[model samples]
Target chain A: MSHPVACCYLKTGRALMSTQRPDARQLPSRRIADDLRQAIETGELLPGARLPSERELAGQYGTARNTAREAIRLLTDEGLVIPEHGRGVFVRRESPLIRLGNDRYSHKYRESGLSPFLLECAKQGKTGRFEVLSIDQAQPSAEVARHLRLPMSEPSVLVRENVFYADQDPVHRVTTYIPWTIAEGTGLLNPEVGHPYGIHGILEERGHTMTRLRESVSARMPKPEETRYLHLPPAVPVLDVLHLSIDQDHNPYELTRFVMRADLTGLLYDTPIE
Target chain B: MSHPVACCYLKTGRALMSTQRPDARQLPSRRIADDLRQAIETGELLPGARLPSERELAGQYGTARNTAREAIRLLTDEGLVIPEHGRGVFVRRESPLIRLGNDRYSHKYRESGLSPFLLECAKQGKTGRFEVLSIDQAQPSAEVARHLRLPMSEPSVLVRENVFYADQDPVHRVTTYIPWTIAEGTGLLNPEVGHPYGIHGILEERGHTMTRLRESVSARMPKPEETRYLHLPPAVPVLDVLHLSIDQDHNPYELTRFVMRADLTGLLYDTPIE
Candidate 1:
């Protein structure tokens, strides 16, 4: 059984402040997280056991609903708890053990232009599935306008927002946009039904390929909707990665914006020597 | 005049509630940062502008001392501001733009049994200098203990600490611990002087080398000291990457904890065919 990780005093020689183990009364939410964490560790709360509703748990722990919820979120992020939509949260049977390495990505891009990461997902039975949220052939926002190099007057375009799940759990959520005229001629015009090929794979097969790709990564606190969809805790960080793929002619083909559960994926890189 | 970054809107669409647009009532510190950003875009600030001192800038902007300092820190993480200890912050006149995608780490490892990432640093240029922080030849921590297969009582000896900058700005901060005792034997034992070889390079020379590596990536809010060392803004995120390297016998050689500036580095990966 695991307990709250007890790290030895690292700054042992520092004399500025006397160090003492934080007693139970120090922090309300942290104390709740620890109390519940102890229960989970000691088998008082078995794996897959349905935890009490947030309000009940709050009352039991003698804390506010928000504090109890926050504690649950911490355990959730640590892979100890699982929250089910429209259902009570449960203890996760096991933590997701990820193997972080670069072997899969290099093989895909070298042998086939298809992203190896995507290929590995398929092979590992972690095939990507999308639940289309909303689709619109609307005017591109200023940001999209610049990325796609469309004139401000380029009118309405196609925008699709969806959540991508692996093994029935939401892992990423994306909102992608493209010029309507360009997309209208393509199969992506149908938002209700997703094509067998992801948009990138489809684009490559159609010879409207992305010869160059640029990406930017950042992180921020998740908002309410994102937190709900991701089932993430307030302290759990998300990876905000923006991908811009351009054609051989340097014409931007697509601009994809997405957030991924950082714990689920490791960024890998192998650059060509100059 | 530069506009407030659009990122805040993507985060919270209710921009009206959060953002205060550039107005006459704007604080001088904010105004200073905005003005400098605009001047950079317009080539007025140029590169390497010896920025006004914190006190001077506070006087110029009619703002408090702390606010002016924070404004500069924000720009520093944006890759526009460069600060020097004892010297005033400057507009980064010329700093090597380190490209993350140009070198293939795997191939270098396969050929030389050592990575260029370590070698290149040891063989420094005018701008490159590696400062070794604290080095402890002591027992591994709990995380390292599990990886090195050391019993709770049996000490799996190691060293852990940071790598500082040549220009006194932190390039990357890392704490690496290895199980092998050769690390202590290899004349690489002092924090006051730089090491002749880096971790990987030294391991290769010692004849126990890693053929592959695995990295786990995540991001988090930087601790106060980390933010100051990395010269990061409180809002800016830092990449927390952990690398585990195994030797030919599949024995773990090193466990490295690294924190990189999310904005400064791009991580790329190419996987091999299965």
Candidate 2:
């Protein structure tokens, strides 16, 4: 029942909450999560701070132990705290990932010699790297074939898959698909290992200039295999984005199924209105 | 344990699955959720389809009763099913909520007399409506203040709050913040009951002439209040977005916080890459 690490955090957080408006009529689970989330947001409980155990929280809040556990589960789902199997929960470490926005396509970034992902990391004062999980020539899903405008008789596509790491965390898993004709003709069917700017550079070099993109985003609980592959924790959802990379001629030469840990990533879109 | 409604759905879903590739290696809970979700997607279980009760699912899947309940919870989180207390779960009725994209500021939509939200619903073959909750002059939170570029001494902001419904389901709860200067000068502070295009119309007429929009999108578990207001089910996450609306002179005129039910909404972003 003892909480050795959370004792100091509790004192500071309570003092901080007193100055704010009352929580008003939230349930025990919500109040607890809100209190801790506030503590995390306000810097009363720093990242990596160990949270009070369920038993200690139950005793402190005078609520049933299960309610306290639910509070932690809520925070876990919010990506505010992470539980380490036998070790207790700790405030989740948050490292911002640069949202690869429309600017990544700019000639400046492409000419800078750093991949857009790496440029983003540098801007954010971090380092980025990607490890290739695979590169293969294979028949694609029907959705992919359709997006690439490949004929039903088309046989294969060059699929390049990798896990992008930001701040040493595996943040994104991407699978890029290109039709066989372009893949074979552009010499992208077999990539030279670890090219800068990833596939965008390859496409640019081959005269397939990417000018527009259409992206659809959805959230879903990851399947078990995805959980393992993405290192996602329980209650963490995946942000699945389907991107159709269009060229100057309006051809969708690249179709990417991008998956990111919802708990950790934020996407930004900025564009001129009219 | 008897399921009067789901029996025919199961047979047809199984037949459909046979023609499609089988789901390999998914656990019992996942396979159960996947089957029902497939049924929902393929029209075997149409919108408002009554899902089998937990007991019925348990009997059908040969899983522990709790496992079947977990399966239902998964679908609920995906926003594919809605669980009504004492009434069992139903396939969630989805009406598209048009993602407020960069094009909303385009003269075409602005001049079309339909607000972007209305235009989106119309495009998807449905009607959209919004009910005003409250309008007041108040100090916004720090985040909103920053986005509005309000000076510290600025007294108040005109806050317009409303809930948007698509096909009678509450889909978005938004709070729009406008700086005091604009609020006072334009007579928008205590204006009419509704503006057709919402805040954008007011801004356009007042010469704000929005030229750019920056949006950040993330997902989180809805608060208890949000659950009540939006009628969100347990485990369903809400897609939370923050918008910074900018004028030609690079001044931020509107700061809007938008919350939408994740299960029923798909956000599409189409933009020029470079």
Candidate 3:
């Protein structure tokens, strides 16, 4: 029951406007930023194209050097451009979009020896790996407890955390939770399950074959810790994907939350329309 | 093939860190912003709670008032808080998350008189409406043309643009394109389709019964025009959903792009994992 805060005034027909006219009263920096942003969007400035130096921009726009610097900072905050320490600023090149679809969970692929991340990376000619952060028993959070149908008073979940990487760059931080009943005396408690099918494969062997998956997707600015872990740039948001795997008996057996760098991830879903 | 730009350095095991310690060498403004950001994230400062006055924060943190102001500015840019014209700053209250699921397109709901947006609003107890921005014939973009399998040289699509609002707050900007072959002499060309079944119903009547749908989802920062149209706050990213409708004959019939405010919208997909 999250309530949206009132953040904007009601405006009509604004979208139909053809161009964003430069308002005479706008700050000089904003006008400059808008010009550069349009150029980037319209392909005038391609990805990885270096922007004119602040001095040149200032001279061209007839603004102060600080005004030009502020405009660059504005683009940097929007994630449109990156400023190198010694080099000039350039448009940020996007990562290859890895489209995750419903078929990704199919048994055919699950049995393919590669984990889903690695499989997707292989499809796109990129190398993928993950580092296990920890595997330990922990009290389930209220939301996790509700989803897993665990008793309120029980500390009954094994938490496995990992950081997934694409070509050595951190892309997603995944935290998985399993009920102690399902995790105990199983490979689920270990960081490396040493199975081609991974954790889900082990679950299947224990009769918890996944028949369905429900994904809840949202996005938000990364917290400081996530920023550090993901090495996210300023102003880049992260996709928060909450996945629940349901077994044949309709039991929600597993819950995993993936915090992914939005710039590098795309989700595709092809489903029969009911 | 969108390549992810190398944005972050390789980092491992950072997620296991217990706390984000304040670095002694960090700038005063950054350190102050970090403290305030931590307060906001940890619920020490609840949504809508007023932050301390700049003078108070400066005195408390042994920093200049300008430094305190800069810290607050950082929070504002991150969309963690908002400042009033005359009043002090307060933590931003989030909008209620609208969970859009696969069932939203079910024929049962489509037959219910209300449009999909209105139906969802009824369920959520929030008023929803949309303003038809424009309805006109246009040349399809290359992507749209390819999806509809249209000849490259034809102005062969009718485009309908609308802005959806929940509780009077704009939340999504949608642009739908229908190949002229399907749109000719149909209600689909009208801004208001004037039918309970909406556009899909019209497509069905015209022998294009939708059997499947494909949605490609990505996210990024809003362009300046989007910021104005959606009334987005600084640092709020948007979800870009590209939708294609496939008919029973496996013909792609419709293509629509929905640019949604990430802060207020969530997408839910419940599907059997094949």
State, as a TM-score between 0 and 1, how close model 2 is to the true structure: 0.77
The digit string of per-residue lDDT tens for model 1 on A63-155 reads 558767877766664556777766998886743423323342222454464344445466666765668888778887787888788876665
TM-score of chain B of 2: 0.73
Q: State candidate 2's DockQ.
A: 0.42
Predicted candidate 1 versus true structure: per-residue lDDT over B1-274, tens digit per residue: 3333322223333333235564432544556677766677678877877777887666665556665786786466455677888888877654332323223334444456433434443444424445677777787768777766666665656676776453455656878777646576764465543332245556778776666565666765565467678886333456776766767677667777777665444344322223
lDDT ranking from best candidate downward = 3, 2, 1
Cα displacement (angstroms), candidate 1, residue B146, comes to 11
Interface RMSD measured for model 1: 6.5
- Model 1: lDDT equals 0.60
Q: List the lowest-lDDT window of 10 residues for candidate 1 chain B.
A: B1-10
DockQ of 3: 0.60
DockQ of each: 0.13, 0.42, 0.60
Off by over 4 Å in 3: A1-25, A42-44, A59-62, A153-155, A194-197, B1-25, B59-65, B153-155, B194-197
What is candidate 2's TM-score for chain A? 0.77
Q: After the best TM-score superposition of candidate 2, give how far the Cα of residue A63 lies from its true spot, in angstroms.
A: 7.5
List model 3 lDDT by residue over A1-274, tens digit each: 0112211212541332235364542566776788888899899999999998888787776656877899998899888999977699999998778766777678887656776667788888889888888899988999999888887667589999988888878888989998998888998777767422488888988889988889988888887689899998877888899989999999998998989899987788888876
- What is the CAPRI rating of model 3's predicted complex? medium
